[model samples]
Target: MFDAQYSENVSHPLRVVPLSQLARAGGLGLGAERSYMAPVLFWIAHGQGRLSVGGALRGYTGHNAIFLPANLSHGIEISPRCQGTAVFFAEKSMLPFPPTELHLRMQGVQVQSEMNQLIEELRLESLSDSPDRDLMLFHRAALMLLWLNRQSGKPHVPSVQVSDMLRAIAQPKR
Candidate 1:
């Protein structure tokens, strides 16, 4: 059986969706309920599953990562035991970097050991109610992305620039 919940927040050009509270009812499938209008970064841990995105099945196991472009239909099916974090933001969140470029860079890049560590750190940060948790996690997420991009042979961009873009994306629109 499949069961899921959906929640989202919109702040004009920036939107944040917290999908961490999701729990599979039958413990069979793991991952997001559905794709969103904006791009998404999924930091999944302690789960063995396969993600169906754009009509393709991308398999993932312990400490796996996946990126979904905006409006791309995707789903996750777990092996009865799964848990993780899903962070979604708009394509406009990272200005200057074309969405197509970012998507191309992230596609087919498997999560590595270091990336898994970063995901774990971000997961712990998310569990805390501390005010700085969000900021810190955002930084870590950007770093993870940067690392992935580098591994994929994508051109290097300044980390500071990425951080700034992430901050802008996280901010509530006026």
Candidate 2:
């Protein structure tokens, strides 16, 4: 049911929707309902806006990237001048990496390049209307997820809460 391995080794299961198309038609975000589907990647090539991540509102501008975990309630409020792409990955599409949330500046060379290239490919493929677009999108999306994970630095291990510890000691379970 899960394939964390490279996408090339698994059946294609990804959908890449171009934000430019949606932007041209009408703005997205603000009204976008909070989702609980899968991890989503948002790349801003231009403009700026505010993003709501798990109830935490964050602001972003051009060249910014946001990686949101599936369980988080996420949405965006694109500015009138905002422009970019949003990737909605199906659950388990880019596996192996423990679920994580991030807001990258993309100022680093590697992060910027990988993101731009991936978005460019998405834009092109989105316009091509190819029969194998699903497979192609999957391969790129997986790679992008892996790239973001690598650039996001070391994994974060959550610290146990003191309250939980006290509760555990107060009420021992057999």
Against the true structure, what is each candidate's TM-score?
Answer: 0.54, 0.65
Q: After superposition, how far is residue 166 of candidate 2 from its true place, in Å?
A: 44
Residue pairs in candidate 1 whose N, alpha carbon or C atoms collide under 3 angstroms: 30-78
Best by lDDT: 2
User: Could you give me the TM-score of model 2 versus the true structure?
Assistant: 0.65
lDDT per residue for candidate 2 within 53-143, as digits (tens), equals 7677779988887877765666677665777777767675535343678787878676677789877886577556789876776666656
Residue 27, candidate 1: Cα error in Å is 12
The deviation in Å at residue 22 for candidate 2 is 4.1
